[model samples]
Target: MRPLADRLAALLGPLAVVAAVSFVSSLGIGVMLPLMPLYAISLGASPVQLGLMTSAFSLMNTGGQLLAGVYMDRYGSLPFIRVGTALYAAGNALIATARDAVSLIAYRGFAGLGAGGNLIGSRVYIAQVAPPERMAMVNGVLASAASAGQVIGPAFGGTVVELFDLRAPFVIVAVTSGLAFFGLLTLPVPKRPAAATQRIGAPTSALNRSVVTLLVANLFLTSGFGGFITTYAPFATELRAWTMLEVGLIFSLIGAGSVVLGTPLGHLADRTGRRRVGVVSTIPVAFFGLAMVLDWPRPVLYVITFIAGGGLTAFTASWFALLNEASPEGRKGRTFGFVSALSNLGTVAGAMGASAVWQLFGLPFGLVLPSLSALLAGLTLLALAPGRP
Candidate 1:
């Protein structure tokens, strides 16, 4: 058994630094998410326009991941991380000064580039440093940090918006992103080993039919969830007559569930089977998403949302563990980037389509989009499980 002191040191080392960077960067994103739709509305954005604006981020983010993936394997992730965090800060600063919905869309798309870089780079870095036996735990730690950031950022950002103005949150996002950039700069960079500098396009057996199947599953899953998020604030506000602060509180519940359950669930994934945990968790993830669309009491809604958040954390831990294990060793950057890009594609499809459905069929009908997507994803997993596991 490892000493307690050794465990503590491992927890607080470079791995922790990467997790901290993810937390700070994700905090900026969380700060803006619950408030952005309202801000667009203030700029006279209609439902379709709001959907477009929300999707602009995902579209641009996909492009960024594709580009970063090609290069990061050739170079390394540190430069991308620094640049990505800076882009987030700069984009938010621009967003603070936006005069109309068009500008908001443009700036947010630019910020998406930064978000993509940060996510792909961070994942690649973790792949390099994490001990294989504890990959799920490391992912859980990183996810928990991100979730904690989401919790604090939205709750605080909502209060800031309510007390001050819609623009206040953007300024706060910029500040937090800037802090993340500087924090990333503090990490040491040693010369890359020969094996670490392999060509980005090198062929590997890991990127086979099974991985492709999983990516397809990822696309469906993220799309449903992404669509749900796009419609979330507006639905909650319109159906429940919720205030901005109330909406933020509900949004924070997702993060709270993740923070509370992430580690334990990851440990569960490691012990049982990642695929089994992911498959079992999908039902609750879908159910809770559908539940939030209903007109439950506010407190009841909070409990449901929290459980949904836990479901998401468990599902993510399991799926990511599978992906990490399957990825080719030297080509982790490209693999992670590829998966992120596919996931963002689903986000774009879901967000844009959900709003359109909401506009045409009503909010409750639109809420069904993600739940349907989750069910499809679950079905895909079930079919593959017998073959793979």
Candidate 2:
């Protein structure tokens, strides 16, 4: 236990710095989530306008990630982080100042670009610095931080929104992001080797195709999840008579489960083959989406959400492990950037698709989309047997 403590302590400093930054950034991103639709409605935004705002952010977030990856590969992580953090701060400020729905949508897209930069840069930085053996642990820790941020952000944001106004969350996010910018300055910038034969533009076709397939699967699954997340509050308000606090609490439950289980699952991913861990863990994970569709009692909903969060961490840990292992040497930064972007793409598709479905057919059909998405993700993983990799 002493030795384990020492090892964790040694890893904690750098990990903590990155995690802190991730936390603040994620908090900023998530703070507005529960309030977005409400705020838009207050601004006289039509349902279609609200949907467009969410879709715009998803699209920009995905596109920004791809660009961030290429830039990080060419330049370095530190520059991107600095620039991204600044953009995030700026975007939050814009959100605070937004006077109408159109402006809100435009500003959120700017915020999405910043988010893409921060997320991709952080992942690439972790992959570059952490020892290969400890990659899963580090990734898990980061994921946990992200989950913590997601959990806290909504609760905090809800309070801020209630206390002050819808714009209050944006102000808080701007401040938090501002602090993270300074925290990031303390970390050492990793040096990129100039003599390596592989340039940033090389094709990734020959690398582990299985890993790519898994990432695509994740994109599909996440898209569905994103759609549900964006619309869940609205559905609950309309269908279940849930308040903002209740919605925040439900989301927090999901985050808490991930924070608790993420590191252990990551360690397991390292000890066990990533592919095996992913395949085995996805069964229960898919059920979380199904549970939502089932419309279980509130207590049962919490249990299912917890289970789903655990499954999410397990899936993410293994997926990160596989991505790191499969990436070509010297290109992990770019590879991860692309993967990050792809996940955002999934969010865009999910949000837009779900919103459109809900607009047309109502909440039940919208819920079914995510449920089917989880099913497809599980089946896709099963089809890509580790033996093929």
User: TM-score for every candidate vs. truth?
Assistant: 0.81, 0.83
Tens digit of per-residue lDDT, candidate 2, span 1-389 = 67656756665676888888888887876777777888888888888899789887878777778888777777888778777888888898998898899998899899888888888888778776675566776788888888888888877888987799998888889888888888888877775644465546434552467557867778877886877776777777887788877876767777888899888887887776666767666666566556666777878878877867776777777777667666776666677777777676687688789888988998867877876676566566765546312
Instruction: In model 1, state the lDDT of residue 58.
Output: 75
Which pairs, if any, clash in model 1? Answer: none
Scored against the true structure, residue 42 in model 1 reaches a CA lDDT of 94
How would you encode candidate 1's per-residue C-alpha lDDT over 285-327 as one tens digit per residue? 6776567666656677677778777767777776777777666
Worst 10 residues of 1 by lDDT: 380-389
lDDT score of residue 43 within candidate 2:
81
Best by lDDT: 1
